[model samples]
Target: MNTKLIAALSVLLVAPAMSATSLDLGYKAYTSDTRDDNAGAYNQPFLKLSHFNKADWGTLFAYVKLENPGEVKDAQHGADGKLTVKSLAIVDKQIGSSNHNLWMQNFLVSNRTVMEDNLYLGLTTNQKFGDLFINAGAGINYSAASFSPTNASFDGLSGAAAVINARYPFALAGLKHSLTVNYEGQFGRDGEHKQTLGYDSYGHQLITTLKTNLTKSVYTKLHLTQFDSWGATPNDGIEYGIAIGMSF
Candidate 1:
């Protein structure tokens, strides 16, 4: 048993793993309960669906999500868009021994339920250099709302927006773990040929999320988000949330 012979044997032992890949399906949920001294306790919940498959080029993925019984929508008496859905696809590849991923998701829902519905398109590329991964991307959003105490019309109005995201991943207890930070921004104006929404601007949100696997078919996540706006007619605020789910 010589040193060179041992070295060659080691490479052979690990080479099989290099050719093998993985694919898994799982569900995730985020639910939060809050208590306000001046008001009653409140709750908001969301669920996410995910698919991941490995390929020669990279890993392919699809994810879907929905937010139900949200804070503001409840106050509207259920006439608004009470559910928010999001869909995404991306290619993830490892580079220079560091994992890299390029992905995008379109969020098809809005804070205002009566809106004609909106889409937030986000594109990001991340590189893992050791324990921390760095990512940056651009996004766009657009939507218009219809509101009426009896019967209202906002179909005439429309808005456009942009977004960005950053994340990092590593290992915990021999399992994968990640921390994600996201930022979303929207530009307000009229669609087709209409005046701006007051010649003013509206951009919202700073969010943080933590992700990990609970089991082979289950995963968990926690998130917090905030919305900030400028000017009067006061259109802005902050929010907190938590959730967990099982994946298929």
Candidate 2:
């Protein structure tokens, strides 16, 4: 297994032992009309397992995804054929006497099939604007895939990355619903690396999801994502999907 995957799994295994941990397993089926430069369009279904832990020190979130299950040649297959793992840990530190929103964040993500292994460490802050909550962070990003023997792997210090996540929740017609928008981007990479990787110097993704509960444990999601670029491909497309999931 890759180091990224190992680290993510290790956290997942240990998180349940911590106080205030929640686990969720769900299956998502969505079709994307967007086309990848190399793999074209992928419309396969995926299963996701996620864990969240909150503690006095900080919080941790981890997830593993199995995409295109049982299909060997699916367009979306990654390093472990169809497995993708990601984990994020936030360590809380009061910047000032009253700044409780500041935190140190570490994010790790890897997908062998896509040939990506990346890590980001930086500072983050959370804020609330009316009924909307937002979390933003910026930091350095390193890709272990740069050293991969694979030809198209992203390598070295990819660049600086920034992320923003915002959510708003409301009740409509006696049903609870939430809308979330997430943006992630990498910038300031070498031009040669960009060309070699078949991507732009600035690569990013903006995703918005609207989720509504069908029952206490069952919910549905609508996703719309704009991919500016990813992995070894230059993807500029809008992808949309609908999914149903049950949380326990």
Best candidate according to TM-score: 2
State the TM-score for model 1: 0.53
Q: Which stretches of candidate 1 lie over 4 Å from their true place?
A: 1-42, 51-64, 69-105, 110-113, 120-128, 139-141, 150-160, 172-175, 188-200, 229-234
Give TM per candidate. Answer: 0.53, 0.74
**How many pairs in model 1 have backbone atoms within 3 A of each other, for residues 3 or more apart or on separate chains, i.e. clashes?**
16
User: Model 2: which ten-residue window has the lowest total lDDT?
Assistant: 21-30
Candidate 1's residue-wise lDDT over 105-181, tens digit each? 33333334222334333455656567665655444444434433323434332455554556787678977767888
- For each candidate in the order shown, give its overall lDDT on alpha carbons: 0.45, 0.62
lDDT of 2: 0.62
lDDT of 2 by residue, 1-248 (tens): 24554565355443343543333333433234444344544555665666566544445565555555564435555422344455555444334543244443445444553445456667777789999988887888766543133454445776888888899999998999999999988898656557555677798889999989878778888888777766444667766766777766
Q: What's the count of clashing pairs in each model shown?
A: 16, 5
